[model samples]
Target: MSYHNPVLLQESIDALAIKEDGVYVDVTFGGGGHSREILKRLGPNGRLFAFDQDPDALENEIEDERFTLIPENFRFISRFLRFHRIKKVDGILADLGVSSHQFDEAERGFSIRFDGDLDMRMNQKSKVSAKEIINSYSEEKLAEILFLYGELRNSRNIAKTIVESREGERIETSFQLKQVLQKYLPKAKEHKILAQIFQAVRIEVNEELDVLREFLQQMPNLLKEEGRLSVISYHSLEDRLVKRFIRTGLFSGEPEKDVFGNSDVPLQKVGKLIVPTPQEIKINNRARSAKLRIATLKV
Candidate 1:
């Protein structure tokens, strides 16, 4: 039940440029660490809404009158906020990627160190588990996941091997999948390779990238005139999307320019990328890959 320290806590919250009376959001309210900090800086009139798809996160809900926890994925930020009779917020903070608690819990199947079921669904209620993907996906489909999600160079061969191995029996757990591809995991790079493979499967199971895009698309409409968007991404893919969206307001391609060579964008970058310091990383290793990007509505 312990949800260890959050990564890049102070830096991410500072990037929000929180206002005493303005409404805010913590889109990834896993351990409630960032949410708690936001509350500490808010005034009596300020309101905060947080989101988490995982049922486990409900346990960590903050108990402040000004704070409300939404037990759902952040991808539905706009829909859920509207349901609560809210349209605009002063600032939005998203700490993307998996929570440390997810990795520590062996049964969650988010860690390679443990022998657990292949159930990497952030929402335990989700029907599509990692087991289903590894056992049912065709070689071509599996290869695509490994190559695109995992960034594996020998994805085709890896997929073929998985297909061949799983044919004899169902791949029911993390350890089983590891054993099937034991040949690829050498002592020198075992952890790195296994992590990449697990990351690909987890991302696919949760539809992380698609959900991210959907959430980002809603930011412009959800924010107030001077509202801020503070996001922390754990990998290059998510960071790229945030960086691009902030710069040009699109995931791919350049923004259109007018006769004066001025282009319109929903949000403008607040500052350079913010990362955790050595002291913070030493305290929480997960902070190593964290990248915080802050942006505000374009004038």
Candidate 2:
């Protein structure tokens, strides 16, 4: 099967306003879909660099002279680009969150429907996996992940149940974990709750929130003056950080104003937030929760 079907393809590409001779970076290069679109817009003189921590993505790397695929986490985007002698770029595009390929492969263990080993590391090289988080994390830590990352309302009870159940045997698989949380799973909303649980595990395994903050901090320095940034975030936590960073150059609530009564933000919002059309969502259900935010770097 195809690795992934890029969400908001055209909308994201259009937001970049690609220049024929400009340099660009696709910070999340799953399946090369977005990279291919960017390459098509670039002239021979233009250059594109793509990053994907998943070793699986390297299989889809484009064999083009103008394109360079970096098989590493985008959290170090600036460091990697600089190593390639690229100080600044015309634009950067990031489609954050887990890719469809990761979820579909049962062995990768990203979905609740799968009865497979709980291993949700985006980078196969990573030491921690969902299995570790499920089996070893303390009840307090588990509750924190469920509440903050998954937004689960009954996090305390769920964490308590997990700790109680794991005393006899290690929770080894997705099915095992599901069985432990069965009581908390609402009958009519089982899938929804299960998804939330899996999401929480995945985020913890990958340290996604920390990675996102690190990547966003590098954007202003990586982008040239007036360069664009088009990011698509799937969950509220990710969206909140992106929105706050664009508005105030901070991931928190608000920025402190300078003595001159001006906020020292590096980015200027480009337009209103964009979402997938009903047609697009119908074609790819994963696009349903996707939110695109665009901004341009201040000179």
Candidate 3:
């Protein structure tokens, strides 16, 4: 399980303002890159817990007395942490979206560059997969996913084409889906368009946005006063949610205010948004779109 270096490693961790004796959670412990760093900074009394639903990630778990790896999705962070008798934490870090390992593995079907089965389940045990969404979903439903998740303007035509093509033969493979969508893939922007299409399918299959919402809603209650949240998001959709939630404590719209014009937002933004330096992006192309946002529970 080879994973790329964690994006915004130093910056995101710095946002945590770690206390040597504090407890922390790395909610996306892909290859233990961030967790290892956290452990390095922690003292003997400090504790670190990580979560990853991917079976492949389990192989890369760290061997440290103070660190615990939870073999479950981060959306259940509150429940699982409760089971461990942990009701609050000093900081929480999330490196959101798919990991490099998931995209590099041909069988995962997460990469548009690969020609593999449409099995983009982060958790192998998940019931729904890209295959089921592509082949079984209705044209209208498919169109909605593409428009909303992929932000594709021509989603209706794409959905109509997919529904028609799959009628002749089931769209089981990535290359096969590409072939069906070839007419829409202009050479000038083929890669970008294909990426958007695949992104839509992957998000739908994984219920990523819903899971994110669930995980975020738990933050206010889970974090102690002034507890930190450091998140790195790859795409605009995820970034928007984090930005909005941090500012207004709601995914959309402004928070309600009383007669005094005071709104009770749960979290406050710590600083301006951060992105990977040109040097970092040069080293790892995947870091190009990474955006780091820091927040803390409002006092």
On TM-score, the leading prediction is 3
Measured by lDDT, the strongest candidate is 3
Candidates in descending lDDT order: 3, 2, 1
* Model 1 misplaced regions, further than 4 Å: none
For every model shown, what is its TM-score relative to the native structure? Answer: 0.98, 0.98, 0.99
**Tens digits of per-residue lDDT for model 2 on 205-297?**
999999999999988888998899999999998999999899889876677787999877899999899999999999999899999999999
Measured with C-alpha atoms, the lDDT of residue 10 in candidate 2 is 96
Candidates 2 and 3 compared: the better one by TM-score is 3
lDDT of 1 by residue, 1-299 (tens): 25857777788888878899989999999989999999999999999999998888899887899999998989999889999999899999999968888998989999999999999999989999999999999999999999999999999999999999988999998899999999999999999999999999999999999999999999899999888999999999899999999998998899999999999888999888888899888877888898999999987
Query: lDDT of each prediction vs. the true structure?
Result: 0.91, 0.92, 0.94
lDDT of 1: 0.91
TM-score of candidate 1 on Cα atoms, chains taken together: 0.98
Backbone clash total for model 3 is: 0
How would you encode candidate 3's per-residue C-alpha lDDT over 1-299 as one tens digit per residue?
Answer: 25757888999999999999999999999988999989989999999999999999999989899999999999999999999999999999999968999999989999999999999999999999999999999999999999999999999999999999999999999999999999999999999999999999999988999989998999999998889999999999999999999989998789999999999999999999999999999988899999999999999
Instruction: Show where candidate 2 strays beyond 4 Å.
Output: none
